[model samples]
Target: MGRKEEEFGYLLDNNAANTEVHTKTGSTDQCSQHSSTETHKSLESTYLGSDDDEVRRSQAGQSCDYGEEEGHLVYHIGLLLEERYEVVSTLGAGAFGKVVECFDRDKGLRAAVKIVRKFESFREVAKSEITVLKEINMLDDDNRFACVRMLEWFEHQGHVCMVFELLGLSTYEVLCQTDFLPYSVDQIRDMAFQIFKAVSFLHRNKLTHTDLKPENILFVCSDYNLEYNNDTKRDERRMRSLDVKVVDFGTATFDHEHHQSLVSTRHYRAPEIILDLGWNQSCDVWSLACVLMEYYLGQTLFPTHDSKEHLAMMEKIIGPIPPHLLKLTSKQHYVHNQRLDFDESSPSGEYVRKHCKPLKHLQRKSEGERQLFDLLGCMLEYDVSRRITLEEALWHPFFSPMRTQKKKRS
Candidate 1:
């Protein structure tokens, strides 16, 4: 059969950015074609295989001797799961679960089926992530946010399969390709605005994306034929927009109810959260600033460190909040001074004293760096009550020029 006529089926086009598929007769042919395209040049040739090299390498490292036995096991598992989708390749494996390649028989579609292992805690987190995704999908029908869309969910072989739209490259992958090059100011603004829109939508719906980072953002190609150069003029000015989709909602939580658990990636975690204080949707606002700073600066705003060092680092940047604002902290000691005392020798006091030096040193950086640092620092304050609100941040001068530049470019 011809390429287009070969038992065609529609998959949840996970590519997000580039949707067109230029098929070839074989994997070698596909590789050859892609090799000639500048945009795809950096992609490892093994990714084109029906079964990628990573899977082969993993299987080779397996202790099992029976080749057919393992294949048979997977086949039986697929059969037991109703065999609606053909297992094509493995996307990723993790402590929590493994995601496999699958093609849907009913729709003739491809999907990433995240298989939840039998561990109790693993299953719980997987279910929680699924719940978060479902909530997000139901909240917005337009799907403007960069979120992975769920195709289907089912249980089989003592595991739960979450079928998701397979995405192409993550921001992590793109960053690797560019060798950690900072994105153009326009690119930063565009990405930041889109992220803000997504966060705003979630906040409006009483939800908070507890984890926000570069790795969670996915890219779509505005022009597949175009080269992957760092030239912003060509990529930024393109009339057609083909990039969107954010993935991994495992740590997301609804803000309507108060949550006490300290959940968030370390570097992105707000100071209130780190200090074991009650926080609201504004925590996400703090993280958003950090993520945007990393995009523009090609480095993390506040690098990760031990809890003690991290607290010290925070104090250095935002400075110790006035006692009036300290009283607004949701923590009992700050509220009533009953449970704990904020004496000079206390952990809190020591953190504040040690961090003061670094904050003053950071003030001596370049103007652009200082501007970005100041903007992010305002939101990342240790005192939640003293931190800048999302609405106030949106009106800040740092973003005003960015907004004007974006409008002019558009």
Candidate 2:
């Protein structure tokens, strides 16, 4: 590698997460020698605005063109940010903007800097995210929860820049790497425990994550190995660290805040959200159910993007939406004659039938599987009132072994 590239810090793949690799780029004398590294195969979260009204981002080079190529600030390689973080490479990009990996000379670590679009709407979203992150950072000062930590923030060339501790791949990316094989019940249990603890902390603080899909949940370290499975006769990759954090707080809402009629990603969305029935923390639980189910099956339980077909999939898997819920829905077109406007003879109806089955039928006949499905049933309850909260879910039999471990430790 050329000296220039080395000075820019080691550039890895688009998604590889790195850490502690501090290299001195001639611009600064603060940087130390290179240290260690890790892999983050992907980043799927979006960050959106401003910490202050005065610290305006740069206006010339780019909002990623400053406005020429949409709102992204044109990423100039090796550009110095806040005089402390030097941009190395683009790690990922999304609707919000882009995230650049930078070498933090002050801390001797690699950081993921989220660059948000300068558009007013995007900026407002970014501002809201900053508020939520600030509250979370204050509440969890010791970092006990499994949440992505925001180390700092700044404005540069008209873009809101959020600096976070570097993390690895999204759970979805890891699932894809494993060739879509189902995660063992034990693996799911461990992952789910950490997820629940993190989410439960949010609920206790009166906040709802609103978005909880596998793609939004990320591993802290994606380092892994390929192990030959004698039974499956396939080389399966096992993650070295199951530790994960829920990301993308751009959509998280507090209880007293106005609830958007629609929230969460299509497949992970709750019935209450789809029906426009007003929701709360229970909606997050429902989304977690979908995420856990995906981990168990190695694929999305409800793969459809269409809201109507998604409802059909849910009905097929969990049973009919309660009459009260259907009766209360403002989206009247979705119902006819007091039933989902689904015709058993229609092509779409057949498609739903071909793809879905009762949740009980989808699970293997093992005690652990049964227990997981049982907890899922509680979480998937159509009535938000009846749906299980993350607190209650932690005590469910599926997590009994985990609770036992905790008890032994205490």
Candidate 3:
């Protein structure tokens, strides 16, 4: 809407040093909110409905007869918008919007543009995402968090298009390709350190990434590998190269903001979120701990589907919730007295039985193993007040190996 030509030059000229990382974590129910049918589309549209000639004009072009999914507009490869970005490919499609790989003609950079449908809810989400990103981006000049950098954004047709730097494979992609083999301790340490820095940066600044997970964490470089050997018989040393950037800020909220009860993916969710207790940055630390454990064990630490079962698994693994925290939680019905006395144990028991061995596998007698457990214990601490803070985690002994290794390499 402003100086279109000058903004393109400024975006491309911006380097990694200017990239800001604002993290977002989400809940299964919160995620599902985006996945609902035509009813959701209408709600989002109603929420974002504004008296704009451009919106009505754009709506006129959106025909239900088009092959696009219901409530979604049709997008095709090679369709250029705003006379700046050309859609090279569709990266992924979600309930409200689709991400596309676009070639920025002005900057000659491959950018990922998230095109949100002109509906009000989608528009609000896009705008909120932009505001958070800008706030975080303004804080750091060195790009320590490795957050996906936002480039220029604009409105095209009836959609709000957000452009970001294109990043490489997600941790999920690497995990799947490697057949879920656990990363070596050293590699895991390095990865966790980077992740910790990102989380620390956000926490120190009073921001929280509610959705930290394998899928949202990605490698910063395209050429780095996690080291996999398909020949099962050969004994090969594990490759340790790693540098990750956290992405997806759709659900991130500030510390002062009203925290959501149902936030973050179920597996990595913190107890505060599950119990409807007020939460803060500690919630992200909880998710980060789960993520680190998965990196070392190649599976989710708590893999239950339902909230009660999830709480049960937490009890089994992390022990019962402290009384103080129990009182703070809104959903105390799940807890009986001082312990988590569940009426039915089938759902919780099912995953617990299978993962019991893997859970035990983490309890090696080695000192390194003990340190890992200590850090995890603090991170997974049920009480948000006593749980390890991001800064404390960075100073934890668990990362000493990474610090020593970095010094030696230097």
Candidate 4:
């Protein structure tokens, strides 16, 4: 690895900048394949089937007796690993594997252990997540950034278990429990500020969180209050603390990594990804924009999953895509005459026209609301080159209060 890459534990892919991702490798399954820097290279090697003498020597006493629950690693409540982490209960489960709440005997605290599935693909992705997390831990040892802290990791049996700081409910879980009521402007400000700060920090380090969404954004403490809502004629849940952290870095990519053709959950996907025009850090900005919008509205900003309809909806909400970008896209089937080709009279087309309206319509005359939408506009800019970077977004008019508060504190 180059010195620059070694310094950061990853190098930039100069040749892959315009290298379009051509597969169905969206954020759900996409994982980084770059070699790690010297700092965490051994850690990666150990967790990724330590075959070398140094790695095998370092991981000498660890057990290799892992069994699977369906496709995920099997772990029962009260099961202990390394005689340090005692399983408390299952936190959640998905394709990646299961996250179990563990009692950390050594640290005398709780941690969330992500037991990766045994599949080759899943294990590889988990290794990638570990690499990124180790890099994040090294980069932000002071914990100034809002990304989740991976306390440690180890291979148990065949499962590469990752121990994370047990956090509160994901924003999606809270939003669901609250019956889909949106957050107040002040609340969104606090949460978005932290999220943007984290993204800025990652971008500064040349990492891009390709799958950012509400579910991936979690509260550090999800304690909330039940407040009466006159308009909804029922009680609504209000977050007691707006503090949040970004999670799920299995798809996080360094600038030097191979650019996956598709990334991000469908609703939050950037236009460039859909059009196959290639992407970079700006894609993170676009997903962040969708995420902030979801927090404000208590629902996904873009509700559909179809590519053509999604583009049509984008046109309806944020004006047309620039013809030059349309012409440049490798996804020619989705474009015609330097414009998105779609039937306006079709049922899907009707759905687009019905579900989406101009961004102006979603805003009110209130300064906060106006400024928030204005910021979203800059973020959702069709031209990736013109979209506001998180660093720039942090200084927008909407976050004036955050800046002022910082000034007061300093």
Rank list by TM-score: 2, 4, 3, 1
* Candidate 1 residue lDDT tens string, 20-91: 222221222322222222233223211111111222223223222212222212432344245587777555
Q: Judged by lDDT relative to the true structure, which candidate is superior, 1 or 2?
A: 2
TM-score of 4: 0.82
* Residue 32 in model 3: lDDT: 21
The per-candidate count of clashes, in order, stands at 10, 17, 6, 3
Question: Best candidate, lDDT-wise?
Answer: 2
User: Which stretches in model 2 have alpha-carbon errors above 4 Å?
Assistant: 1-43, 46-68, 231-236
Clashing residue pairs in candidate 4 are 12-256, 13-256, 21-261
Highest TM-score: give the candidate number.
Answer: 2
| Global local distance difference test of model 4 | 0.70
lDDT of 2 by residue, 133-235 (tens): 9999999999999988889888998899999888777676666555666677887999999999999999999999887877677788877888888975866
Ranking by lDDT: 2, 4, 3, 1
Question: What's the lDDT for all of these models?
Answer: 0.53, 0.72, 0.63, 0.70
Minimal lDDT window, size 10, model 4: 8-17
Q: Which model, 1 or 3, shows the larger TM-score?
A: 3
